[model samples]
Target: MSFSSIAAAARPRYGLSCALAALCLSYSLHANANTPPKIGGAPVTSVTAAHYYSFQPWASDTDGDKLTFSVSNKPLWASFDSSTGRLSGTPIPPANVGTFTNIVISVSDGTYRASLSAFSVTVRSLVNSPPLISGTPATTAAVSQPYSFQPAATDPNGLRIVFGISNKPAWLSFDSTTGRLYGTPGATNAGAYPNILISAYDGYFKATLPSFAISVTVTQASNGT
Candidate 1:
């Protein structure tokens, strides 16, 4: 292009104040990720409490609002607190080991802006055999009472537990897909099942956990729902 044209185009951005401001913005955004932000801290996580743990983040933005936490890959049993930026919960039960868990914790102004952070969780159960149970939930049914079963257990490997109520009443069913022990009861009152067996896994090695056995407990309801 022409020399005069180039000078004219650079005029606006070349001003002393504008150049300095742009330089500052570039430096701020490129700061080290490990450098703590305002709520300055680390995305700390742990996995010692019954295949469960918490994740919290440090804040670093200009706003004064609180931080928040959450999970993405492993389904957690507890909820996140936005006000304190803490994530306390049980990672999916029966603790399968060695699985790669990814969770996202986002901090925001509660308006239109938010920043996301990620965490990884690993599980390890102490036993080899799934948990075992001595008694099962009742097979009896009421008009609206469907029975549910959640097995009790003991892992030979001593792994942490995530369980299931395997042997359910006619009205009830075990969610082989999600481990949700649920079902409906239409008429039965009692059954031959005195105990229910569930396979539980522990957080072991890279698995974060392995399997074990657990007993089931039954409750009553109506629809096989």
Candidate 2:
């Protein structure tokens, strides 16, 4: 055979081998790529002394790889679970009353790691108290008449209080900051609105007024028959 013919025969085999090598290299690189684990949670920033506090960060790994948990600047009064990333404990008054700062929780999937943003927990010396809500809501409302009721609340710790209502009537509007429930009922809205609950939250604790109801009745004619 001529030298040129020998070289041409070998060319096809060399090209085939190179293509197979490239395919194997691509697969190897993808199979070995690592995915990092993710961790996140919103822990309460303020806790009262002698009160129980707890938080657990959620984590996940798409590769189903086993994950390990870790923490930095954990509070001395709290206990941690390495496998689950839970931080919880009670702060003893006078001893643990202070602020713990720059606490970070992290997770690792052996090859890669992820972490939550640094956060802080403040332990207050005063005991926590639930906000107070006191008032009687009128049970009966007349259609086409303006109706209104405002609940009063006080928080001993003077924390900003926010109001909330559940099972509210469709005809009424509520003020979250003032705890005022007011609106006019229409003829179509005449019915018994039951199990209405008004609540106050003082940042940490909640106090709820006893459940009440309102019955809408037809408006009485102004001129007596």
Candidate 3:
């Protein structure tokens, strides 16, 4: 073949090879563009109520696209930041103190999105301790005579204490803050009073002491003879 004719034949082959290479490249790019982002393993977390809580999820897109995050079925007291892929907020009392399940989080690369479901999170609350009776009170009193007694108690959390009595006699009175039981019995009060129940309470929890027996004796009037 002549040199010009050989060059002309080679031109078509070279152009065809370039076109085939471009077609393959275009297909590879399109496939990569359609690939979805991947989310890393979801973790179980425990948080405390009235305290700050935060967690970050890992994710990536094969096409090097920027990924945004979001969460669904999250606790009402908490929030998620899509820009940072962080779930964070301060949990409230009562409502937020419990085990929560099936939280879903999604990551998106504009066109495609991926999700993780059934995540577990727990919020623990501070427990209030009940008060305890330290010792028994005096169980006897004289009619028409002066009487004084105080019930002792302690609280595990060092909370302020209040005292109360149930089924108390008409002559008896109680001091809630000092826990003092003081009353002067009248002549009609001489009897077996078996219905008195003493209780102590902190702000949040309460404790009651067992019932006790109290015997009142009749007092004789003294006169100069």
Task: Quote the positional error of residue 147 for candidate 1 in Å.
Answer: 41
For model 2, give the 10-residue run with minimal summed lDDT.
216-225
Over 4 Å off, model 1: 1-40, 44-52, 60-74, 91-100, 111-116, 128-225
lDDT (tens digit, per residue) of candidate 2 on 75-135: 9999999999998998877889999999998999998989999999999996667888899
Best by TM-score: 2
Instruction: Please name the candidate that would achieve the greatest lDDT relative to the true structure.
Output: 2
Query: What order do candidates take by lDDT, descending?
Result: 2, 3, 1
- What is the Å distance of residue 222 in model 1 from its true position? 56
For candidate 3, lDDT tens digit of each residue in 42-65? Answer: 564887665677888899888888
lDDT, residue 114, model 3 = 95
TM-score of model 2 (CA atoms): 0.55
At residue 65, give the lDDT of candidate 1: 43
- Name the runs in model 2 displaced over 4 angstroms: 128-225
The residue pairs in collision within model 2 are none
lDDT value, candidate 3, whole model: 0.80
Q: How high is each candidate's TM-score?
A: 0.33, 0.55, 0.45
